[model samples]
Target: MLKQIGNYLKSKWSVRLMTIFYLIAGFNHFINPDFYLPLIPPFFNSHEKINVLSGITEIVLGIGILFYPSRKYASYGIMIMLLAFIPSHVYFIQINSCIDGGLCVPEWAGWFRLVIIHPALLLWAWEAGKSSS
Candidate 1:
């Protein structure tokens, strides 16, 4: 099963799909800034600098992942970024804060993020590396 999954990810469609996902996510960082604002850690709210930095990072990382030479690094960077954001998710759940003025993001959302999204991201990164190699 693992080998089959690996073989499937080696296809061009998989790479393109992963790239598209990053592109959408990166673009949405700007298009839907408010949606992500609540995910920022409170400690960084001393001023608005953190928000700008986060947006810039997302855009850069997204672009980096699209380029063949930098895709692997970008994948690693994205994985790191996702892991780093886990605390913010935890904080959101603990404080019962609404995500983008909507109802609180369900507790399971965080778990899904950690278990599903993060691992998928890591696999995407591995695929990126395989393509580059």
Candidate 2:
């Protein structure tokens, strides 16, 4: 099972799709900061800085994964980043923070973001690792 999973992830298309996903998500940080800003933890103090920092991290990770020499490092970085953000998702759930548009986003949306998207991000990173190998 592990070997099959490894082989499946090694496919070029998997790598390409993961790369595109990372690029899109990273760019979204800059293009739609308001959407994500509400999700940031209160400890960050300044939302703007956190927004910019997230964008920068995303952009860097996206670019790094595409570069041959940095691909492994980038994949690991992305994996770590995804894990790090899990707490913010927890915070969002606890506060029931309304999404940026003022309408209350469904409770499931938070869970989806935390459970689904987060793992997908990790898988994308894993795909990057396979490609780099």
TM-score of each: 0.77, 0.80
Query: Which segments of candidate 2 are over 4 A away from where they belong?
Result: 1-5, 100-103
lDDT of 2 by residue, 1-133 (tens): 9667667666666666667776787788889877788788887788888778777787788777777688888889889888878878888877774655653667888789888978866876876675744
Quote model 2's TM-score.
0.80
Residue-level lDDT for 52 in candidate 2: 80
Which pairs of residues collide in model 1?
none
Give me candidate 1's TM-score against the actual structure. Answer: 0.77
lDDT of 1 by residue, 8-119 (tens): 7756677677667766776776777677776777776532455556667767777777678887788778778767767776667666555656547667776676678767
The whole-model C-alpha lDDT of candidate 1 against the native structure comes to 0.69
Clashes of each: 0, 0
